[model samples]
Target: MTLCPSPQFAIPDTPCLVLDDGAPSLGESLHCARDWAAQLPRAKYLVLLCERRSHFILGFLAAQMNGMTVLLPPSRAPGAIREILDAYPDSACLVDDGPPPAAAVVRNCRDFHPIRSARQPASGEVSVPPEHVAAIVFTSGSTGRPRPNPKTWASLVHGARLAIRRFGFDSRHCIIATVPPQHMYGLETSVMLPLHSGARVHGGLPFYPEDIRLALERCPGRRVLVTTPIHLRACVSANLDWPAVERIISATAPLDKTLAAHAEDHFKAPVMEIYGCTEAGSLASRHTTQEDDWLLYDDFQMTVHGEHCRVTAAHLAEEVELADVIQLKTARRFELLGRHADHINLAGKRASLADLTARLTAIPGVVDGAFLEPASVNGATTRMAALVVAPGISEARILERLREQIDPVFLPRPLVKVASLPRNATGKLPRTELLELYERQVMRR
Candidate 1:
């Protein structure tokens, strides 16, 4: 399979990125990438630590053009950075702004200004070979230690094309994403979608509801909100009037129907939920308000073998096993049961932690919550515990609502009320952090 269907340099004058200051044309981006690539040392691997979306895109393209593999770590924590560098001993860090992280050779994007090359830039398309490794995206480390997943240029391009077609995006659409560019979902939807398709991406990564609305206001064309369940829920719960958005795309975590419906009603747009993981870029998406099952991407096939399943596509290097437990409705559609790791069996009764968490968040006045099975000591099944953030509602009332939704045997014991749940940037509650919170807040008490 040939990797390059379209050339990055072909669309020179087209508007590619919309920033607060001004829009950068595709020509300018290519020139900037070329300038940056010229200064980079002859390293086989480069670690991208760019916080801004546009800069991240610039570095990504430059690395690709320079024939260097880009390493995208799950986070910029000192430990995470160290792990990535340790894994790729010949790697160097590329930064758009801020002080360079310790323990790696640093290349600042700002230092390399965009300049017109002596030779005229190629007006024609360039093709990246199918086997070339474009990037290495690290897992979220929610289950355990973050692991690296290498993606070929062909796979990235194929996935981007799938998203563009699935969402019906074109040059007329402008994307505003809340997730960071390093995350897989963010990389595909916010960065790759614009480059592969003709869509324009907003440069800023908006988090607060007001900021999100303001970003949308600044955009000139039809708008799309690329965000996660957490950010979408906050936007709806805030009740702030939203700007006109053509549609919304959600990923990073499972979006419940209630939240999806609320977002659709509040924004007056369809809420599309994407199902994927770090291992398989984005495989399927659904309009949550209309469909209960996910529609897989074209040319992708899945095989269910008991509790686990594997996915294969023309873009994928091999059949990749999924951590999710799914009910295969057809060859191209499936209902996500939950993560295999999230299922808990106690006293011969089965329940999914994801389902319980969704139920907890659905209760009125409950802002955010999570249900975790306390670590077992002495090989005994420990009862479930909960950490909830409901300032106005009493713990008794919260439990009453939970009792109505869940089995008494599965009701969380010692439900701890708190100010907020410890959610990461993408709105994921890491199990390690959850365990830490339980040990300090609940077990200590």
Candidate 2:
């Protein structure tokens, strides 16, 4: 708890955000946040749509200071934006990008400058009630429709402090994140961690391996790369000379160990994975190359009965039941089985879709892949189908390899070769999109 930003946090003069031009101190950012908050339109919720990390942080703080809850949409898709806006009638959209997506009272982040030095408020510190609702983060709609999860200010701060200690992060470490701030994983590592732990974060949302490399090069210190499994795979495969990195953190989807090892070898940095969901900001961490069990952060407790697991913590208002299957190894350690949704019972035989997909992607020429179990029709289960991204490997060859590793019941009926999977920024394939792809490519054939 030594690194935890106190409940009555005092703003610091250390750099909080690193931009191409210069680094902005925490106090400076707060000053601008208050100024911008005063001008923003009155609303009960602020739907943030800023692409720039700096703007997102400023908007996040401004909304909170003004007592407006920040609403993070699951994605930038028009349908997703509309869904959130329709649900929250008193929400205003804030965007730094070109134009707003929906028909609402939209405000542009470009209209206000957050880095402009101005007269500091008399207190020079931001203090909000611990019970204040900070943000409502939406779940990634991988399985189904995105659901909102409200997070309090105290919970956010507590999660960040736990992360800082777990990752050995401090003000001296510079964060270069590929994931966008709207995602809960990105919000914790890229935004909240720095705000509470005194770490400096690069403002750019780097996606390409080269962009990530450049972002790391520009920062001066031990650098941490906050990203997802898809981004890590791209970086490892790029084969470009990477900059010195202190560590690499990945989440949003389960990371393949081989890819994690390759990334660690290439970057000469330890690769770590986070295990959590939108309901809980971040729960545990594990060094991928070293172990399969996840070590829960201090004060987190887990209990399992049958296949369902419930997690409890002081920061959480109530115990949260996890959707995934878990095996408790100790009081604070556990092994994560695939999600309940990914478990398939086919022809009296059971198999995990996630495990099968991992096996397919582990093939020599496979770039990416996923196993899809279509909905049952007339009480009869359908054969599972697969989508693969291996230009060098044929559908037959991929199936042959899968046959050796998995049971015959689990082999894909028609493994469709594809250019790419429809992965979002966080590397999650939405079920709706996957089914659409299946219909367009498979049924049409």
Candidate 3:
């Protein structure tokens, strides 16, 4: 489990990061990392709060060089930041382009500049031990309380290498990612992939479809758009003229086959979906339009016993239990049934919430929706409830359409039409938020 056979940055003097201002070479990035590392306070842990992708990578490398554990919060919410700080009292904060949250020790990355005099000692090949904790990425808290998953340098680098090979990426590819840098998908694809695979990443995190189009137009060479299903749906529905995209990568939520086919037809590129979690990183990927089963990455093994399955990889510290139920076709291929926690049985019938939601969003005139299990009152079982955002569509009309697709018992009883679902940056619905919405909107009535 060697971190790197030879200690060195991948490709220097190549365009590694494409920022709004200008593209930064790997050499310059290494120089900035050296300067940033010199200014970091002596702390065992540091909270990385960089909104920009380039700054996030710089901070990550600087922390790695300084031998400090980087704590990647699930979100920048005040409560989430406070929880991490409380968990690690000896931690400090690092900011690149914004004011630091209330903390005793904070370092601003904007203050650091590449120093020529400081280049001698720090310049040259950089390497870290296989066991060094590169980062502690927290889960999305979609199911329960957010849990921290520590990733080692060896694991992170190994995963990056696998991604590079899986995607067939080379120095000619430029990535324009819409997801936030804090999320695991964004961190691995937009951050680590470029560092390890010799590809360049766009610095801007564009959300609007027009902005994404403009960002892609600005990038040169073969381009790859790393985004989620929500963003892809919006982009495809908008029907805006797009540049030549070599490929599109989607994750963080299940991608509908219809949408995937539409995106491929519209963009003239294939849509590759990555299946993974915060605990195991990226384990497998598939082309939604071409395959029903996912192909596992090299050096990874999947073992299933009864209803539970575990994944083991060279980069992983141990075998990780998968949250989703899978139908294993072979050692390297499987079809995802659904999340183990998302399956529910009522009235002697079984259904998956994910499947229901997918069908809900597929209906005409339905923008977004979710199926939730409302809290029971006085030990009385309750039927599934729905929160939807469909303007100018009647609840009866939506239900009429749903009746054709799902069984009567699985259909949502009270389909509460709302403005939108409370989705995080990565387009994942938190269970707590869904419960709150149900209690506020449906329960009262």
- Candidate 2 residues 198-301, lDDT tens each? 78899888889999989999997889999999999999999999989999999988998999999999999999999999897789999999999999999799
> What range of 10 consecutive residues in model 1 has the weakest lDDT sum?
1-10
Which candidate number has the best lDDT?
2
lDDT winner between candidates 1 and 2: 2
Candidate 3 local lDDT, 62-168, one digit each (tens): 88888899998987777889899999999989877567665547887678773233223323246777799989999998888899999998888888888888888
Question: Could you estimate the TM-score for every candidate?
Answer: 0.93, 0.96, 0.94
Off by over 4 Å in 3: 1-9, 101-104, 114-124, 376-381, 443-445
Q: Summing lDDT over every window of 10 consecutive residues in candidate 2, give the lowest-scoring window.
A: 1-10
Q: Which digits, one per residue and each the tens of the lDDT, describe model 1 over residues 1-445?
A: 3222555412556677887667876666777777788888779998999877877888888888888999988877787798788889998898876676657888886787743334345332445667789999999888887888999887888898888778878778888999998899998999878886667888877899999989899987899999998999889978988889999999999888888988989999999989999998899989898999999988789999898899998888888899999899988999998998888888778998999988988888988899988856575456888999999899999999989989888888889987777677898877787788877886457
**CA RMSD for every model?**
2.6, 2.3, 2.7
Give me the candidate number with maximum TM-score. 2
Segments in model 2 whose C-alpha atoms lie over 4 Å from true places? 1-11, 117-124, 378-380
